[model samples]
Target: MNTLSKKNDLIDEFDIIAKFFTPLAKDAPGTFGLLEDAAILPTIDSHQEWVVTVESIVCNVHFLPNDPFELIARKALRVTLSDLAAMGAKPYGYTLTIALNRDLSDSCYLLEKVSHGLTIDQAEFGIHLIGGDSVSTDGPITLAITAFGITNKAKALRRSAAMPGQDLWISGTIGDGALGLQVAKGILSKQYSDLAGRYRLPQPRISLGCRLSEIAAAAIDVSDGLILDASHIANQSKCRLVIDGGALPISESVSRIIADHSEMFELILTGGDDYELLFTAEPEAIQKIKQAGYELDIPITRIGRVDSGEGVDVLDHNGIKLNLLIEPGWTHF
Candidate 1:
C-alpha cells in the first residue's frame, strides 16, 4: 500500500519485461508517471512542448469477447484520451501496443475487424498512428494506447492542485458504463441494453475539458468507477470529497432499469468505464463554465464540495449520509 513497495513491484515487472526492450524507465516517476497514458517528459523548448498520457485495456478483463470490434477499438482509444482530456491536453498523436492471444492472431477475420476499429478511432480523433508493436501472447487480447497531446504550459490541469472548499462537478452521468457492461454480459435484461453500450463505448469529454482548461483546478476522468476515482482526487488534494447522492444525475433510463434490478445500483457506483470528467473549480470559475456555453449537450452537475475530511461520502436530499460499503474500484495486480 505504501508508495515504495508499489514502485518496487513495478520495477520488478519492468525488469521482467525489459527482456523485450531496453528498460523504458529507470526509477519510476511518481503517480502520473506510474499511471496515465504516458509520462510528461522534460522539455527544452518548453513553450510548445506537449502533454502525454497512456492507457491499456485487456480482453476478459476490460472487455467481453462478444463486444463488437469497432466498439472495442473505440473504447480502447477513448479511455486513454480521457486521461489527456482530464489534463486539458490537445490531441496530437498516439502509439499503440496490441497483444493478441495466439488464437485471435491466427484468425484473419478477427485481425481485420480489430484493425478497422483502430482505423476509425484514429480518423475521428485526428490522431496519427505514429508507431506501435504487435506481440503474441497466451493471455486474452490486450490493447494499450499512448496518446501525446499539446497544451500551453500555463493551461495544463492535473490531479494534484485542488483546493479546499472547491466545488465538485462531473460531466455526463456516472454508473452507465458499469451498467453497460452488465447489459453486454446479459446479466441485465435487454430492456436495459443502453447501459451495456455505455460500457463498451465511452465518449471522452475532450472538447469540454479543453474549454474548461483555465478554470478547473484539478480534474480526472472517471474510469475506475466514480467513488474510487473521486477518492483518488480527494487523496491527492488532501481534501474530503462529500458528494450529494440526491444531486447525482442518474439518468431516467438507468433509474427505470434500477427499479427492476436494485442490486445494479451498486454496479453503477463501483463500475468502471464512465470516461466523463470529474473536476473541481472555484465558484466563480464554475459559474463561468456554466455561462461559457462549453457544456452544450453534456450536463455538468455540481454534486458536492471538497473539504477537510479523510475520504469520500454520499448524502441524500435531506443531508442524511448513505453507505457505499463496497470495496474500492479497479486495482491492477
Candidate 2:
C-alpha cells in the first residue's frame, strides 16, 4: 500500500503520495502523514489551531491557455480555500506560486489581471496574500497556492469520521462545473453563461462548512465530482454509500443539458470541479442541518445513506443499481 504500483486500469494518486511524500510528511508532527485533505497544527496560545492545504493548477490542463487571467487566478485561490472550508476552518491567509512564460507578449498584462483577481477574492474571502514565489518557464503557466485557516474546534472535521447509518448530505447544486467545462470546450451544443461561470468561478461553501462542523459527523468538499468525493468518505470511514440518482440536486442549466443529451449524465456524476460540500450527519441532526442551510440561504440535499460495506452504489429511482459509464471524477497521473 505504501508503494505505487499499477492498479487495475489506472494509477492511484494516494499510492503515489504514500510512497513518495508520506515519509517526509511523517517527520513533521502536524502533517497528518499526508493522509488528510489539510494538515492541522497545534493550538496557538491555547486558543485556535491552524489548518493548511496546498493545490496546484497547470495551464491547458486545468484551464484553457487563453482563459482570462482574472478567472484563472480566482479559480486557483478559491479551490484551495475550498479545502479550508471542508475542514471547518476560517480563512487566515494564502501564498501563491506562479510560473510564467516570460516570452509571451501579454505576460505582464496577464500577471496584472491575475493579481487583480486575487485581490478581489482576498476581499471576498477575508484573506490576504502573505507570501509566494515566482519563476520563469517556457511551458504553460502554472499556479500553486497554499492557504491557511484557523479553527476553534477541538479538531477539524475529517473524512474518516463518517459512520454507518449516517445520512449523506451535500450543499448547493452539483454538476454545474462539469457542464460548464463542456460549454467552455464547445463539446456541448447548449451554451449557458451561468454554466460557464460555474466552470470559471466556483462558489466555495465556507459559511456552510463552518456551521456543519458542529452538526456533521464527517465532511469533504466536492471538488472532484460527487461520486468520487463520496467514495472518499466511504473509503476513509470504512462504510458503503448508497446514493439515489434522482435525489441529486442540479441547476436548471444542467437539467436542460441532461434533457438534451442523456449521455452527459455520467459527466454530471463523475466530472470534477464542483466546489460544494458533501458531508455526513446523524439522523437526529437533520433539522439543525436544514435550519443552518435555510438561515444561510444555501440549499442542502440528502442524496444518499451510509451502510455497512465498502465503496459506493448509485441507485436509480426504482432502486436498481446503475452501472458506471466512466471513471469517477478527475485524477492527476
Candidate 3:
C-alpha cells in the first residue's frame, strides 16, 4: 500500500484517496477496494443478520487534537464498532468519511498518520474498509464512520429488553477513560497512564458481547458515563435499576487513587467514554455469565439488579440511595 505522499502537503482529492484509503478497502468483496460508486455488504444468512450503526466524532470533543494519530483513527472506528458489540454482532466492514480541517498545517502528514492507524486497526479488528469519502472542512478534524456487523438472525441484543428482577453486570473496570482524560489535561500524574490508554485505545468487548446474546436480556456499551448508560437501560426498559456503590469493579490503580483522592470518585461514576459492556440477565444466569467471563478473561461484575421502578438507584453503605447525578427523573429521588 502507498502509505504516504512524497509531498509534504496533500496534492488533491484523488491523490489523497489513492495513496491512503484505497488500500484499506483491499480484499473486501463488492468494495472494489473503494474504487467504485457504491459497495454491497458481504451476503449474510438473512437481512436480519446485518447490524448497522454510525457515529461521528470531532477533534477536541470526542478526542484531543494532540492525541496520537493512530489512536484518533482507531477511536473513530472503535466508537462505531462498540455499537455492534452492544448488539452481539461480529464486524463485517466499515465506510469512513473524514473531513480534514483546513487550518491544519500538516494535512498530508495527518492523513498519512491517520490512514496508517486505520490500516493497523482494520487488520486487528478483522474489518475491511468498504468505502468512504474525504473532504476539506473549515472546522475541526472530524470523522464519521458507518460500521456493519453480523449476528444470529433476530437475536441481536437491545437496551429495552431488560426485565424487572434481572441482574445488572458490567465488563471490565470503569473510570479509566475519565481518569485518562484527566491525565491528558495534566490533572493527574503519569502513574495513571493506563487510564489514559483506556481513553485513547478503548478495547471494544466483542467477545463478551457475542457471548451475551444467549445470556443477557439487555445490553449497552458504556460510552456515555456508567450511571447515564445504566439510566438508559432502566428508562428504555421501563424498570428501575439499583446498584451498590461499593460493588463497582475497579482496577488496583484506580482503587489506590480513589483511596487517596476520595472526591475523585465522581469521575468514575460520571466520566464517560469507557467502552465496556453493561448488561442485564436473569438472576439464574449468574454462574453461566461468570463462566463466560472467566473463559473470555474479561472480568464481569454484578453491580445491581433491575427493579420495578422508573429510574436508577445507587445505594450507599447505609442502604440509602445517593443523589450522585443531577439528571432529573433519571436518578433516584
* RMSD in Å for all candidates: 9.1, 10.6, 3.5
Cα-based lDDT for every prediction:
0.73, 0.81, 0.85
Question: What TM-score number comes out for model 3?
Answer: 0.94
Report the C-alpha lDDT of model 2 over 1-333, residue by residue, as the tens digit: 122123222235565445333533343455555666555544565667888999998988889876788999999999999999999998777767777764666554665677678778877987765545556666778999998888875758899999989999999899999999888888875458788889889998888888988899889998887888989999999999999999999999999889988989999888978999999999999999999999999999999999999998999999999996579888877
lDDT of 3 at 160: 98
In angstroms, the error of model 1 at 260 is: 2.7
lDDT of 3 by residue, 207-319 (tens): 78889988899999988788889889999999998988889999877898899998878778878788999999999999999999889998999998999988788888888
Ranking by lDDT: 3, 2, 1
Q: Using Cα atoms with residue i matched to residue i, what is each candidate's TM-score against the true structure?
A: 0.83, 0.86, 0.94
The sequence of per-residue lDDT tens digits that candidate 1 reaches over residues 235-273 is 898889888877887877788888888877777777778
Supply candidate 2's per-residue lDDT for 70.
90
lDDT of 1: 0.73
- Model 2 global lDDT (CA atoms, 0 to 1): 0.81
